[model samples]
Target: MKKKFLGLLIFITTYASSQTYTTNFNVNTNNKDIKSIVDIWQSYLKTNSKEYWNTAETKDLKNFNILNIEGVINPSLMNWNFSNLILSVNLFSEDSYLIKSIFEGENKSVFAITNVLAKKENGNFKLSNYLFDYTKNWRSHSSENITYFYRPDYILNVEEVSQAEKFYSELCKTFNLKSEKLTYFIAKDCDNIYDILGYEYIFSKGMSKECGYYEIQNNYIFATEKAGANHYHEITHFINKFYPNANYLLLTGVSAYLSGEKAHFGKPLIYHIKRVNEYLEKNKEISLSKPFDFYKLDENTNPQYVIGGLLCDLIIERQGKNGLIEAFKNTKSDEEFLQFLQSKVLKKNENLNDVLRKKIKEISKTDEFPNRLKN
Candidate 1:
């Protein structure tokens, strides 16, 4: 069965590769016409009229491949309010051009750079491709179940990839969730991951060198440097698809608990509980009752993982795993879901916040908390 699956995978990839478009062009970054062309395109974005596009067109407007080029540029540019834009053009050939632009937006204060490919038809340059730079220089690999994109020199091991596939499948079954086709991007390191994702994007900001993230919208997992014992942390986020409205506390805490990575560099859960207890003893200001605003906190300063993990474990102990799953599926919003957890799942007659703090101290006494430092 495995051999047959491998063969089918090979056939699909080969066929897909054969169908991709081929283009011939020389890359020249120092072209004067490129800036003029980009300025016209910017005007088109600002005015939302074909007249600006027509002004930069080398061929009939109808013949320009707008579909192919749109993917390379920011889809949000259609709404305007972009500023501090810098444009660079690379002449792929006498007739083909690749234009790169970097700019910022007011909405999220996001910084983005995009590449647009243009080809000359009948002595006019027509847009051919527009996309993020990460889409370029990527090589694809597949296991029986998952497809991953990686840099040329940073391929993941086939056995490791296969293991991740099996782990994800088993998790779906465990959670009683339907599986989706998973894609992984094995970046050389965390910096490479940031480059693929724009630097100014909120998700890309404040991340440490060891951290990689899963993009829920794109259905892709990015891991830096190492795959690290099945990527169970990110996979947990992917598998908990039922809880679309769950708060970051529940989401990050549950994954941190299950993955065991947040526990003192992947130490046992009790160790993390003890660490949080210790942290709380020194710093009395951090409150578990409030929602964790990740945007305000630095990447490494998250207490949510430790406190949240212990809370999740408590929920499982008192209410059972199905009870936790029920809370996830039924909750309408972040606030409502957290209230449900306190009222329904925790079910303590006393103040739940005080109860959780006491529970953390109690759990710190467990044998799982190591005596000698593992590090």
Candidate 2:
């Protein structure tokens, strides 16, 4: 006879003045091993939960000492493969509550944890309690914020659904530098995205190649991807949206580089270089002479995404991150951004046309357009 076993689980929640988190489980299984594990967890709560809660940090959340957690469980959602547990706790000095809902259903579950930070008393944010609700009423309220982007249709690994929420949480932290209300959607494809965002397709990825698209629309970013959901790269474009004066070359190139480099799109760096180089070779005259013009796509034209992406990396190498960031903030028009870049970084009395032309030549390692004078 084979031993029947359910997956392992641990859900904890902590509350205000307690500095610690507590967890409750709703295990659904006749398996002895699963039941034994569940019993051990319950025993720990009976023995050490109070001790853990007392030692929890009474001060700010960032500095707070959080033990395991304290909360109730929802038994209805519990199954051999799926478990839904809710942990509610009070936080800081405020009377507000923080709710953490941990759902491990199927391969991918949603870890929706909301911390209600209230600074009403002494302007100091206090600890709040936790609650779980499948209805999602407390998400928009309770001083809680959610920045999530999800595409249920595109989800292949159902076991990793929680990853989507986790990725969105990181994006909020990295780009916004703080938590905010966020939600993600699933579109049928790139074309379905157009109805929501009025962007004409400037350039799209090859049909065989899996790629992500990030574009600025009405000073906001609208991203479209075939499968790989890269929120970080798309959010970068959203952040840079404030810089209307930013160069298109910087926009596309930096977005791509960050998508591949910072966000780790799994594509080797050389792959990007080769793609850009191939496109440059095929469209030598258009790319070398005029990058901005080349990016404008028609039935016959190819997008300058790779060229732009490489240029962004070049700028980062030449100018520090701060310099590039400042460039985005300072420039408001294409001409202005290019002029600002040239004046700030290049040789004295450098002609814009010559500077751009030479820059491309140096990077590409070929002067395909030597006959064409830099105007």
What would the TM-scores of all predictions be?
Answer: 0.65, 0.42
lDDT value for model 2 = 0.38
Candidate 2 local lDDT, 1-375, one digit each (tens): 000100112332211122222344543326443333334333323343322221233332321212121111111111122233434322333332332334333333442222322222333223222211111231221112323233433443332334444554654454444543333322345443432322122122122122233322321222344443334455445455455666655665555454433331334333444444555556646534344554433332124545555455545556755566667676555577666767775557755445454455464564221211011
The lDDT, on a scale of 0 to 1, for candidate 1 is 0.53
TM-score of 2: 0.42
How well does candidate 1 match the true structure in TM-score terms? 0.65
Best by lDDT: 1
Among all windows of ten consecutive residues in candidate 1, which has the lowest summed lDDT?
Answer: 14-23
- Candidate 1 regions exceeding 4 Å error are 1-84, 92-99, 105-139, 198-207, 262-272, 291-301, 365-375
Displacement of the residue 273 alpha carbon in candidate 2, Å: 3.6
Residue-level lDDT of model 1, residues 267-303, one tens digit each, is 4567556766787777677566653431123333345
Off by over 4 Å in 2: 1-179, 192-225, 261-272, 282-284, 287-290, 296-303, 348-375
